[model samples]
Target: MEYFLGVDGGATSTALALCDREGRVLGIGHGGPSNHILAPGGEERARSAVLTALNGALAGAGLESPAFEAAHFGMTGISRDSEPARAFAAVVAPLLTARIVRIESDASVALAGALACRPGVVVIAGTGSVSLGRDPLGREARAGGWGYLFGDEGSGFALGLGGVRAALHAHDGTGPSTVLETEIPRRFGRSLGEIPLLFYEGRVQRPEIAALASAVTAAAAAADPVAVSLVNTGAEGLAAIAAAVVRRLTWPDGTAAVAPVGGVFRAGSVILAPLKAAIAARAPGAVLVPPRFEPAVGALLLAMQAAGVAHSPERLALLAATWELRSRT
Candidate 1:
């Protein structure tokens, strides 16, 4: 009757999964953003998100007073052993009765879930971009993740902003004509000339701008040269990040799995093709693959590890099966 909990607390949302010793997921819960860095109220906000998700998970699992053997929190902006991590650990300590509690960066759990804790790199390109990798020796390295202001070159925000800039340029007759002029404006229901005001007036934020990436992807799918170029450039930037991680970590076999995770990759081959090609050119040893499990399950695996549970194929298989079933529903 040992229960384990895993929490994936991100910039926009938090998710919790509760499971049994055999790896069958009993419940899943979601809540608002828990990232202490991006939002105000820092620790308080993260604490609320974690509690909401944990309560939901407990309710869904029909467990009112079960003692969890272990719980892991993989949170964004809270690196292992850092000040933010320590603060979060203090904030959640009273809420959980787990014997073992571990906290780490979201990328740590992402790499674990993407490769099932095997040695690999994960390139996350949501609103922002980051590349993290682990070696067989448990050593880790990362590239990018500098946020939208200075970095995140191949992220949704980057692509979306690129589209907006292209639209503006086209309007000013400084750039080649493209459908982005229409496509970008259509997303905000504004004319091309009025789009800058949306950002200047604080009417649009990062997530909204990131959402524009879909329009760019759609335009690329429709064969707009400017949109296609933006997608390719974005792919190249992501490839560079992955390549940087590949270079930082040692691969005895001269090969490593590189999983692309996040919204930007939804463009499918429009982005993947260029990403694969660019990675081949930049880091030949890196291979792009689909993530084996979502980040929440990854956190669960870490929780199991802290509880001294072996990551046996049978246990992993059980977890994977449940993940597949849950994802479908």
Candidate 2:
């Protein structure tokens, strides 16, 4: 019984899955941030995380030893260019014992997962944002994903930044007052007066600021105008990214399926109404579809493909069913 491994390494977390030749998922594991760009000592940290997850999965399956015939990793920050791919290969080769290992950017896996290797678009709005699509002819296109510095519109960072601006504006009586003024301070365990000291004293990570996005969402749900506008703006920005992908792919006009993923979408989908409206206004027939499979599953599919394995509907169903059963346990 040959086994294959799939790893999805994200900026904030990582997931690994073990599957058999027939596509039955034997075990699954998870770990913390594996994106090298964000985490120092990235290569080693990633290696340790992957190994830990693989071992956990094996233990869950009651297997003392297991050999992976092939493995694939979809990770953020791994370049698509050949030169960078080669560099990454060197960094990762010493870490795993698999017979074959393939690595690609997380966007590729997200796209494949959402569409099942078929042609469609995927918009991911998490701590960051990116829009990706693949044409039926295997052509791929992308927009955004420049990180929080330049782009990442509609992402957690974007929401957090907007929330901060709103809070500050309210403090100065320059903008519409909202509940964020109170909520932001509460999150940091201090009054608004201490926020500057907390930030300048190196007591907080910038990403933690984005953690307030959930509170903003809650406030919006409670009818806070400022929060409502912030969420609406985020939805609009995400929709614009999706629209760009649609235009690049030139998908047919008749409810073209678009899969939305990432934490931002999960937390703020109510805001997506305007995004849907915006897309429809421009593309006329685009429909948003929730992802049927996670990005790790897509990595598994790619691993299977790399190993010359054909994925039938029956096989995929078996894998999904097994995973669902395991999840319940």
Candidate 3:
């Protein structure tokens, strides 16, 4: 049986998969950060991530020279117009005799994954936020994802910064008294006064700040009003992104299926419950649905399609079942 490859080059790390013609997963691999804009070493690091992952997958499955018929790479930080995808394709060209190679933004793949390649909307809220959707006619639209400097509302970075700002506000006696005043310090194991020093020395970076999102969620869970409000606002921001994309697409069903994916979604009911309500309010008939698969699996589905492999409903189900089985082991 022929095998295909799929790579999810995410902001934090890279994931690669090998699958059979039947869509059953054969092996999986992982590597370091691949985001071109945010990750260090840019194209070189991206190339290394992909190559190492492919090698790891092959080694894990005890294969010395696995052949790929086609491959797809779904990556972050590169837009549809970015040449990095082409560069990545070039990097892999010599490694395999694949007939087809395709690369796209992580947002596009997330949408494809959320809807199982069906036309629908997906909002990704991890360290960043973006929403993308496809119409039945293959047309697509996007909202947010402008990056942290511009947009990225409802993101972990945003939530973390918000928590920090709220702490400062309370410290200055300008905001409501909340647990964040102490929680922030306790979470970092630093005195509140030392936060500025940490930032000044560049000791606190995006990933470090983004980690504060967990503290915010914990505070909200403990019934802190300010934390609750922040969570609600973030959920609304995420909903707005989904609403904007849904507005641009022509849904075959009166309702568009909306799905949320990413680490931020791990906030659970603290985000999803309100996010569902907010999207429903703005985008009439928008239905929040469970994502069909992870981004890596979505890339696999797209790779199979690129190779002209038939992925009927039954086949997709088989693919999902196969992934479940492999993941458990």
Candidate 4:
């Protein structure tokens, strides 16, 4: 009757799932923004989100308090070595009744989630982008996770920026005409001229800008040349990240399993077409895979691994599918 908990404390929201020793998800819970790098009270916010979601999942599982055998916290904004990650570990360890509490970066959990703890590579493109890889011997490596300031080249934010730039160029008659000139204004419900002021004033936030990536994907689908170019370039950037990780690892067989995740990938063929092409060109012999589960379920697998318990990948995959279906409700 051992229970395990997996929490994904994200920048936009937090989700948790409670599962049994067999990886059967018993309950799911969610809460608001929990990215701890936002400062002011980022740690507190993350803690609250984790606690709230934990209680909700516990209640759903018909429990009074957390009495789990192990738990994994996939926290956003703090790497395993960062002070905040350490502080968070201290803050949360005492709160939960679980005998083992492990905290790690969201990217690490994403890789764990995608491969079910098997050695593999994962490229994540949400508000930001990062690629991580693990070898069979447990050696881990990463590339392109520098954030939106200068990196995140393949992220939603980067795609949106390209879209905005192309739209402005088209409006000024400096770039080839594309659907973005009209579509951008429509997506934002504002005049195209306002974008300049918004950018100059720093009012255009990352998420708002990243939202434009969808417009890029949509226009590319419509055969807008400028939009199509951005998608291709973005895909190349993402693929480069994966290739970089692949090069660093020692894969003697040269057949590496790669997975891409996040909203940027939601465009399906819009992004994947170019991404696969570039990965083939750069990281030859890499095999791409769709993720088996979301990060929360990956956290559960990590918890099980920490407790020295062997998990059936087939069972964990099934449990992840079931949890995902329940999450949609």
Candidate 1 lDDT, 227-296, residue by residue in tens: 9999999999999999999999999999989999887888898999999999999999988999888889
Writing each residue's lDDT as its tens digit, candidate 4 over 1-329 gives 89888887766678898888877788898877677544788767777887788778877788777578998888877787678778787667666888888888888888988888889999999888999999887788899988887789889989998998898898999988888999998998888889868877988767788989999999999898898999999999999999999888978777899999888999999899889989989988788889878888888888888898787766676687779676776
lDDT of 3 by residue, 54-168 (tens): 8887876667775678888888876654677666666667766677788788887787777889988899987889999988878999999988769988998889888998999
Positional deviation of residue 253's Cα in model 2 after best superposition, in angstroms: 7.1
Ranking by lDDT: 1, 4, 3, 2
lDDT, candidate 2, at 54: 72
Spell out the clash pairs found in candidate 4: none
**Reference-based TM-score of each model:** 0.94, 0.90, 0.92, 0.92
lDDT of 2 by residue, 179-288 (tens): 99999888868787666567679886555766777877778788899998998888888888887887777554445678888777666456667667777776666788
Q: Candidate 3 — what's its lDDT?
A: 0.84
Alpha-carbon runs more than 4 Å astray in model 4? 90-95, 199-204
User: How accurate locally is residue 66 in candidate 4, as Cα lDDT from 0 to 100?
Assistant: 52
Candidate 3 matches the true fold with a TM-score of 0.92
Best by TM-score: 1
Root-mean-square deviation of candidate 4 = 2.1
For lDDT, candidate 2 versus 3, the one ahead is 3
